[model samples]
Target: MAKKVALLQGNEACAHGAVYAGCTFFGGYPITPSTEVAEVMSVELPKIGGAFIQMEDEIAAMASILGGALTGAKAMTATSGPGMSLKQELLGYACIAEIPCVIINVMRGGPSTGMPTGPSQSDVLQARWGTHGDHPAIALAPSSCQEIFSETVRAFNLAEKYRMPVQVVFDEIVGHMRERIEFPEPGELEIIDRTEPTVAPEDYKPYDTQFGDVAPLAAFGSEYRYHVTGLNKAEDGFPTTKAELVDAEQRRQIRKIEDARADIESNEEYQTEDAEVIVLAYGSTARSGRYAVDRLREEGVKAGLFRPITLWPFPEKRVQELAKQTKGIIVPEMNLGQMVLEVERVVARDCAVELIGRVDGEPITPTQIMDKVKEVL
Candidate 1:
C-alpha cells in the first residue's frame, strides 16, 4: 500500500487519526479554531459506519462521548478553552468512572471569552488541573500536522490501555495551520482495544482486577453488568464514603498511571550530547526552539533542544538526567512561564532556568529564543 500525503490542517489530521485508531463515535460542539475537528469528524465518521453528533453544548458533548464509550465504542469530544471549562465536571466524572475516552482541547486565549481566534498556550496548566482532585493527567502535545495524526492515535491507545481519559492538546497555531501529512497504511498503526472481562457477568468489577492495575471493561449493553459513579467507588464501582475504601480507590487510580510511568512518558533530544545549554520547549514553541538550537550551533554555542511529546507525567526523569550535562536551561512558552516552573522544579538549581514567554497572541519567534539564549549565557 502506497502512503498518501495530504495537505491537512491539524484538526483534520486529528479527525483522521481518530478513525485510524478505531473510533466509532464523536461528540463535539463547534467553536472557533477547533470547530474544524468536528466538521471533519461529521463527514468522515459516517462513511466508515461510525457516528457523529453535535450536542446542545459542550457539557452535552462531553456527556455523549462518555455514553458512547460505555457502549464499548472508541469515543471522543473536541473543544477550546471556554467550552473545555464547561466540560470539566463531566471530565472529572469520566475520570472517576474509569471511562476510556479521548478529549481534543485546542488552545485559545482565555480566562473567559478573552479571544476567539487567537493562539495561546495558557490552557496547558488548566488541562493538568481543570478537573480537580488528585487524579492522573495524561496529555500529549504535537507541533505539526503529521504529529497531530500520530499523537491522536497514541492518545486513544493510552486511554484504552489505562481505562481512563487522555487529552490531545494543540494551540491555535497548530490547530489551523496546514501542512503536508503522511499517513501509514491500514493495519500499520498499532491499535489496541479495551480488555474485556474474563469472568462471568456475575463476577464483573469495573474498578477491580486481580489481573493488573487496569481492570477489564464491561460495556453497558453487554451481559456483564456493573455499577459506575462519580463518587469515589470501591472495586464494585458503587459509591462509597468509608475513608479506607476511598483511600484505596484513589491510590489505585493514581497508581495505574504512575506504575505505567515508563510507557506514558515521551520526549526528543536534539544536539544535547556535548551541549552545555539546553532549551526545553513543546507544541508550536518547539518549532521556533528547533531553529534557535541550530542558530546557536552555527554561532559556536553548545545549545540543544528538548521537546516533550507527552507533556504530563512531566518527563521529569529525562530532564533530571539532562540537568547533569547542562549549566542552564531555557524554556520558551506561549503562556507566561507555565511550563518553565515545571522545568525549574526538576532542575532544582542544578542549573539556571530562564523563561521567554508571550501572551499577546503573537508567536515567540526563533530570534527571540536565540536572544534569550545569549542573555542567559
Candidate 2:
C-alpha cells in the first residue's frame, strides 16, 4: 500500500530524505532557517540507528562528515550562511579527496551574518567556487517542500555514485515553509551506493583510475588498508610534490564529473518552444518566475521559464540553444546578479540578458518579474 500524504516543513522533509537515503551519520552546528534540518535530524537519525552529533562549530561539523564517510557510512551535514562560510575549507577537502557525503546549505542573506532568518540565493556561486581551485561539484536546488525531500535523496545517491560530495543547496523560503508532500515508494527511487574495492589487500590502489574514473572506496577497517588526504596524492594515497602526478590527480577528479555530464544535469522548462522571451531563474525565486510567465502568457506576451536544477555543471548547451531563438533572456535571483553572468557567458548570440535582482532578504515577487517581462518585451 502507498503511504498517506503528510504535511511537512521543507527542512524537516530534507532531514527525513537524508535518513531515508541511508544517511547514518550527521554532524552540524545549527543556524536559523536551516536549524530545523539539524534539529529534525538529531531526533530522527538516532531513532533509526543513525548517529547525529551537534559539533562545537561548523568547521568541526564539516570535518566529522568526511570522517564518517571514510568509515563507510552515508554521512551528511546541514547549515545556513555563516555556517556555510565556515565549512568552505572542509568542503574543498571533500572535493579534493573525492569523499562521498552530502552538504546541505539552506541559504539566507549573507556576506557575514547578514540576515540569518531571511532568504537569499546568494550562495549559488559559492556552492560552485567558494572552495579553492578548479574542481567539479554537483549542486541541486529545490523550490518546494517536496523537492527538498526528493533532492536530498538525489544528492546522496550522486555523491556515492561519483565518490564526490554533493550539495543539496536550498534557500530559506523553501527550507522553512510548510507544505504537503507525497513520497514515492522507497523501491521506486534509484539509489546509488559507492563502489567498494574488489581487489585483494595487497593489490588495492586507493586512487587508481585505470579501472575507471570511480576508484572503489575502502572502509577504514577493511584489509585493503590505505590513506586518504586533502593534499594531491598518487594511487597509493601518498602526498607527492611531483608536478606530473599532481596534474594527473586533479584531471582525474574533474574528468569523472565532466565526462559523465549527461547523468548530472537537469532542468525544468515551461512553454519554451513557442515563446519569444525566456526567464532563467532558480531556487525559491523560480516559483515567482514561473508565475510571471503564466501571467505574461495571459497578457499575450510570448514568455516562458527555464529553471536549472543542477546549478554547477550548469546546462550551458541548453542555454545556448535557447538563446539562439529567443528575443531576450531575463535572469531573476535573490542576489544581485550572480547566475546572470553565467547565462550571459553561455548564450551563443549577443542577445540582451536582463537581471531582476533583490538582496533585501525578501522573496522576488511575481509582480517584480511581471514588470521585468514587460520591460524586456
Candidate 3:
C-alpha cells in the first residue's frame, strides 16, 4: 500500500497524533497559534466516537480533561501563552491528583499577552515552574511539525505510563508552520494505556504504593471507587494533613520522574563529538541552531548543535559532559533568556556560556546563531 501523507500544520498534526494515541476526550478552549488543534479534534473526534468539548474558559477546559481522565479517557487539551497561565492551578491539581492527561502548549511571546501570533521560548521555565509547587513536570520541545506529531503521541505515553500529566510544548513558529507528514499506520507507533488495577474494587486505592511508585489507575465509572483531591493525600487518596504521609507522598511523586530521568530525557546532537563550540537550543530555535552548525562546519569551524527534545528534567548529565569537552556553548532563544540559565548552572563554569536572546516577536535566525558561534570560537 502507498503511504499516507499530508501537508499539515503543527497544531493539526498534534490532533491527529493524539487520536492515533487513542485520545477519546479533548477538552480545550481556542487560543491563537493553537486553535487548530481544537478545531481538528472537533471534526475528527466525533467520527471516532470520541468526545471534543470547547469549554467556556481555559480553566474549565483543563478541569474537563481531568474529569475525563479519571473516567479512563485518554484526555488532552491545547492552548497558547495566555491560556496556559489560566490553566496553572488545575495543572497543579493534575500533578497532585496524579491525573493521566496530555497538555499541548503552543508557545507565543508573553509575560501577559505580549504577542498573540509570534513565536517564543519564554515558556521554557514556566513549563517547569508555572504551577505553584515543586511538582514533577514532563515537558517535550519538538523542532518541527512532524516532531510535534510524534512528540504529542509520546506525551500521552509518558503521562499514562507515569500516571502524571505530560506536556508537549512547541513555539508559534513550529505550531503554525506547514510541513508534509507521513501518517503512522496502526501499530506503527507504540501506544500505551494507563495500567488498570487487577485488585478487587473494594480494595482499590488511587494512590496505592504497594503496586509501585506509579500505581495502576482505575476508571471513575468502573467497578473501582476511590477518592482523589488536590490536597496532599495518603495512599488511599483521601486528603491527609499528617506530616509523614504528606512528606512521603510528595517525595514519591517527585522520585517517580527523577529516578527515571535517564529514561525520560531525550536529546539530539549534531557534529558535537569533536566540537570546540556547542550551540544548545530547543523548539523552533533549534532549527536555526542546526543551520548554524552546518554553515560553521562548511567554513571549517568546530561547531555543533545540541537540541533537547525533552526540555524538562533538563538533560543535565549529557550537557555536563558537553561542557567539559567544548570550549564554549552558545544558546539562541526567542526569549530574553530562560534555558541559558539552565546551561550555565549545569556547566558550572566548565565552559563559557553565551546567550543570544530575542524577544521582539522575531525568531532567532541562523545568521544570529552563526555570529554568536564565531564570537564564542
Candidate 4:
C-alpha cells in the first residue's frame, strides 16, 4: 500500500503527531511560531471526535489540559516563550500531580518577549528548571519537521508511560519551516496509554506504590473516586504535610525518570566513532552542526556531529564517553550559552569545550561551527 505524505511545517506535523498518538483534547492559546500547532490541532482534533479549546490565556490553556488529563483523555497544549513562562506554575502542578500531558513549546527568542518571530534555544534550560521545586522533566528537541512529528509522538508516549508532563521543544526555524514527511501508519509507531487501576473503586488509590514506581492512574469520572491536589500528596492522593510521606513521594516521582534514564535518553551521532573534534548541538542548530562536520571532513578535518533528541535527561553518559574520546566539543546554540554549561559539567574538563552562541534572531551557521571546531582543535 502507498503511504500518505505531506509537505508540513514542523508545527503542523506536531499537531498531526499528537493526533496519531491518540490525543483527544487540546487546550492552548495562539503564540508566535507556535500558533500553527494550536491552529492545526483546532482543525484536526475535531475530525477524530477529539476536543480543542482556545482558553483566555496561557495558564488557563495549561489548566484545561490538566483537567482533561485527569478525566482519562490524552491531552496536550502548545505555546512559545512568554506563553511557556505563563504556564510554568501549572507545569509544576502537572509534575507533582503526576498528570499525563504533552506540552509543545516552539522556541522563540525570550526573556520578556525578546523576539517572538525569531528562533532561539534559550528555553533549553528553562524547560528543565523553569518550574519551582525539584521535579522530573522530560523534554525532546527534534532538528527537523519529520523529527518534530516523531518526537511529539514520543513525548506523548513518555508522558503516558511515566505519568507526568512531557515537553516537545523546537526552535522557530524548524517550527515554521516546511518539509516533506511521510506519515507513519497506525501501529507503525508505538502508542502508550497510562495504566488504569485494576482495583475496585473502594480499594483504589491514585498514588498507590504497590504497582511500582508509577502507580496506575485512575480517571475522575471512572468508577474510582480519589482525592487530587497540588499540595504534596499521600498514597491515596490527599494533601499531606508529614515530612516522611512528602520526602518519599518526592523521591519516588524523581526516581521514576532517573531510574529509567536509559529508556528516555535519545541521541544521534554522525561520524563520532573516529573523529578528533565533535560539534554538539540540538534543535535547529544541529542542522548547521551536521553541515559543518561534513564540510570539515571533506577538508580533511576529522569533525563529527552529536545531536541530542531527548534533551531533558541530558544524555550525560554518552557525552562523557565522547568527551574522553574526542579532543574537544564545540557547542553552537541559538541562545547566548545554555546547553554548553551542561556539556561542560559532564565533560568536567576532560576535553576542551567551546561555544558559538547567537541571540540576534539569527541562526548559528555551519561556517561559525566549523570555525569554532578548527579553533578548538
Model 4 misplacement above 4 A:
none
lDDT of 3 at 125: 91
Work out the TM-score per prediction. Answer: 0.98, 0.98, 0.99, 0.99
Q: What's the CA error at residue 311 for candidate 4, in Å?
A: 0.3
Candidate 3 weakest lDDT stretch, 10 residues: 109-118
lDDT of 4 by residue, 7-78 (tens): 999999999999999999999999998999999999998898999999999999999999999999999999
- TM-score of candidate 1 on Cα atoms, chains taken together: 0.98
How well is each residue in 1-377 modelled by candidate 3, as lDDT tens digits?
A: 98899999999999999999999999999999899999999999999999999999999999999999999999999998999999999999999999999999999888888799888888889999999998999999998878888999999999999999999989989899999999999999999999999999999989999998999999998879888888999999999999999999999999999999988899999999999999999988999999988999999999988999999989999999999999999989888889999999999989999999999898888999888888877
- Stretches of model 3 off by over 4 angstroms after superposition: none
Q: Give the residue spans of candidate 2 off by over 4 A.
A: none
Q: What total of clashing residue pairs does each candidate reach?
A: 0, 0, 0, 0
Candidate 1, residues 318-375, lDDT tens digits: the string is: 8998988888899888888898888889889788999988989898899999988888
CA lDDT of every candidate: 0.91, 0.90, 0.93, 0.94
Model 4: weakest 10-residue lDDT segment is 368-377
Candidate 2 vs 4: which has more TM-score: 4
Q: State, as a TM-score between 0 and 1, how close model 4 is to the true structure.
A: 0.99
**Residue 303, model 4: Cα distance from true site in angstroms:** 0.5
Residue lDDT tens for model 2, 18-83: 888989999999898889999999999889898999999999999999999999999999998889
